[model samples]
Target: MMLSELSRFGLDPFLKMRHMQDDMNRLLSGLGTATAQAFPPINLWLGENSVVVTAELPGLSCDDVDVTVREDTLTLQGKREPKVEGENAAWHRRERAYGSFSRSVQLPFRVDPDQVQARFADGRLEIELQRPEADRPKKIQIKAA
Candidate 1:
C-alpha cells in the first residue's frame, strides 16, 4: 500500500518525519543566535488614583533599561546585549533574544509626571504612575428635592 493509505490505518509515517524535520530545524537554528520581538511583553493595571505597568525583560539589568513618562503615556526602552564567550567556545543553543526594544502605553488617566515611580527587580520592571486629583473617581450623592 502507498504511504498516503497509511493515514486511514492511524499510522501516518509522514507526520512523524515532519515532526523530526521540525526538531532538526530548531536544533540547527538555535546556535549562538537570538530571537527578537518588536516590544517586550507588558501588563498594566489601574487603581483608584494610580496606574501600574509591569514589563518582562529577562536577561537585562537596571543599567540597560530606561523608562519615560509623559502626561498620559509611558514608554519603556531596554537593551539586551549578548554575552561574550571564549574564542574557542561553541554555542549549542541560544534561544534568548539580544537587542533593543521599546514599548509605549497610553494611560487611562492623566498622570502626575512628578509622582511617577519605577523599579526593576528579578528581570521585571514595575512602574507606578500617580494620576492627577482631577482624574480620580469621585462618588456623588443624590438629595431629595
Candidate 2:
C-alpha cells in the first residue's frame, strides 16, 4: 500500500514529517524537485507607467538568479544553497530553506522588454519594467465646436 494510504490510521503526521525531511535534504544538496515551489517571497507594485517587483532572496548572489520579462509576464528562477563550513559541520537550528525555486507573475499591462532593469542588493532583487509608450494612458482634450 502507498505510504499515504497508511496515513489513514493516524500516521499521517509522521509520514508528512518524513516526506518534508527528504525534500529538505534534496533542497540543501542543490538538487531539483519536480514539486518544488516558489521561495524567497516577493512583492509587486504597479505605478503609473511601470511595474516594480521586489523579491527577498537572502544568502544568494546575482549569479544564482535568472529573470525574464515577456510582454505581460515575468519569470524568476534561481537556486539558493546553504553554506557548509566543513564536512563535520552541522546546523544547530536550521531555519532558512534552500532549493531551486521559480516564480512567474502575469503583469497587468504589457511592458517593454528592452527597457527592463534589474538590480540586486542586500539579498534583495528589484526589477523595474517600463510600460510601452503606446500602452500608457493618453489624455485627450475636447475643443469647443
Give the number of the best model, judged by TM-score: 2
Clashes of 2: 0
Clashing pairs in 2: none
Q: What lDDT tens digits, residue by residue, belong to model 2 across residues 93-113?
A: 986777778889999899999
**In each prediction, how many residue pairs overlap at the backbone (N, C-alpha, C within less than 3 A)?**
0, 0
RMSD in Å for all candidates: 10.3, 11.8
Local accuracy by lDDT, each model = 0.85, 0.87
For candidate 1, the TM-score is: 0.67
Give the Å error, residue 123, model 1. Answer: 1.6
75: Cα error in model 2, Å: 0.9
Model 1 pairs whose backbones collide: none
